[model samples]
Target: MRWALVGLVTFVLFFPVLAAFFILLPFDRDRKHIHPLISFWAKAVLTVCPLIKVRLEGAEHLKQNGTYVLVANHQSIGDIIAILHLSHSFKFVAKEDLFWIPCLGWALWLAGYIPLVRGDRMSGKRAVDQASGYLKRGVSVLLFPEGTRSPSGEIQAFKVGAFKLAAEVGVPIVPIVIHGTRDFLPKGSRLLARRVQVTVKVGIPQQLAAKNNGSVESFSDQIREEMIQSLKSIRSQFKTGELVSV
Candidate 1:
């Protein structure tokens, strides 16, 4: 019943907003207009679906006008919804197939998010190049460094693309960690849990060293490890019931 209600609400709100997005596209260069609309849509979805509770931490770390190569660990589809709560303007590097979905995909295209075809070498390079272009133009780009959601909800091996792009464009890498979303909407299932608490922690933005001899692969590893540690800390607080919602 809850899932059905959520779906109805999503469709009802999505169509009209998508129409508005289409009309704005010709004048919406840099996607400055589209992203905020998407953010509001996400917030409204979360509001109507009371079963999911999202708690955000370290929001103070984000600067209003700052540009970043935002990186996060993916757990489930709900991760994107949780991220939308951040209310920050950024373009996503998403899988190619997602761009084919009806309303959602159209919105992604209108928002100017980059698409990546899995396991295709040229596609990988193109995604990096497009993302780099956005970063160069002072727009933040968000990427899931693991490339896909971890089936076991564990931190998977990091891909070098995000780190490489950040290194090349001289942008700060902001690490974000999300937990409890998998419980709300696990992989390969559409049934929503009655109640679940999701937490997102935004780490301080770190810039690559100007003279570092380490490869981008190594830097990716370092960031992944930091995210692992942050996830562990969030889990501990969850168990202790000490988390204060933001």
Candidate 2:
């Protein structure tokens, strides 16, 4: 019943707002105006659901005036909804298949989010290039460096695309750690569980020395380790009910 109500509310709100975005696309060239609405949609989902409580920490660490390549640990599709708990603005670098979905896909394209075509070298490069363009224009881009959700809700292997993009654009990489989302709505299922608490930890922007002196591979490893540690700390506190911001 909870899942059904949330789904129905999302469908009702998402389609109209998506259409509104389509209408604004031609005039909103830089996509600055449309992205906030996307954020609002994310916030609305969390608001209406009421089944999950979301806590955000270290959002103050995000630079309000600078562009960033934001990377997060992906555990489930519920991570997307949990992201709204953060107040920062970012464009998502999503899979190409997601761009083919009806209303959601159309809205993504209209809002100027970049799409990665997995397994196609040329397509992948083009997508990264486009994301770099957005970064250069001061738009923060979000990517899940694990590339996909972890079946066990553990941090997965990090990919180098996000790090490379940040290095190429001379921007900082902001690592976001998400917790408890998989437990809220695990992968391969749609049921929404009640009274679940999700926490998002935003790490300070990592200005990679690798951008000037080292390899993206090394930078990726460093940031991945930071996120892994952050997740562990958050999980430990959550288990003890002491994960509140100080």
Candidate 3:
């Protein structure tokens, strides 16, 4: 299968790079430069996968060192790699499984990513506690409110964890819509032997801007509604096969 080949190649080429990256953790004087390197590595591997073409829009909307939370729609396995390529120095919460994922886990930890057990609320609590540190350092934390990939490739209702973190840390929320990965290499698929184009739209950044903690929950609810609107605006076009760059 094409996926089998792709997986083989991923491990063959990536393992060494990952090992080197992991080994550099304690000695690496600079963490900022490392994320781009990892992102670039992923971008380069994905290019050779022969199944996807990635594009980004509204990059200018991002502000450097902006402390915030990012929530995006989940589509496919490739979604992870694509976002890493597009996001620079952004630390997002991920499942604890990633920590045991050989070299990738080590690098992720060194980069300040928070990990949760996912199934356990206690893990969420720990992750939230850790996220507060990231916010204080002015790092961007990505969240997929749906908590899991959508089986139907359509939008799923989002959870409140990201908003809770935002409220706890008092940071802005950046809503993003990622289009097209589900078709290329969706859930339970293998080998991207053909090329498919994917687009990432960076929407208007929604600020929490709440006057009090009591309003945090409501404010984040509004922010979620805005993100849903932003994603829906683009969803129709993608579904209709009229997707264009931007």
Off by over 4 Å in 3: 1-30, 99-110, 188-194, 210-214, 238-246
Over 4 Å off, model 1: 1-5, 210-214, 244-246
Error of 2 at 124 (Å): 0.8
lDDT of 1 by residue, 1-246 (tens): 866877787778787677877798688778767787777777777877868878889988888778899999999888887887787789999899888976677778877888999999999889888888888888899999888988899999987878888888889899999998888788787787557788989999987764445577767777889999999999898679797332
The lDDT of each candidate is 0.84, 0.80, 0.71
Tell me which of candidates 1 and 3 scores higher on TM-score.
1
Q: List the residue pairs that clash in candidate 1.
A: none
Better of 2 and 3 by lDDT: 2
Residue pairs in collision within model 2: none
Report residue 125 deviation for candidate 3 (angstroms): 1.8
How close to the true structure is residue 243 of candidate 2, measured as C-alpha lDDT? Answer: 63
Q: What CA root-mean-square deviation does each model show from the true structure?
A: 2.4, 3.0, 3.7
| Candidate 1 lDDT score at position 5 | 76
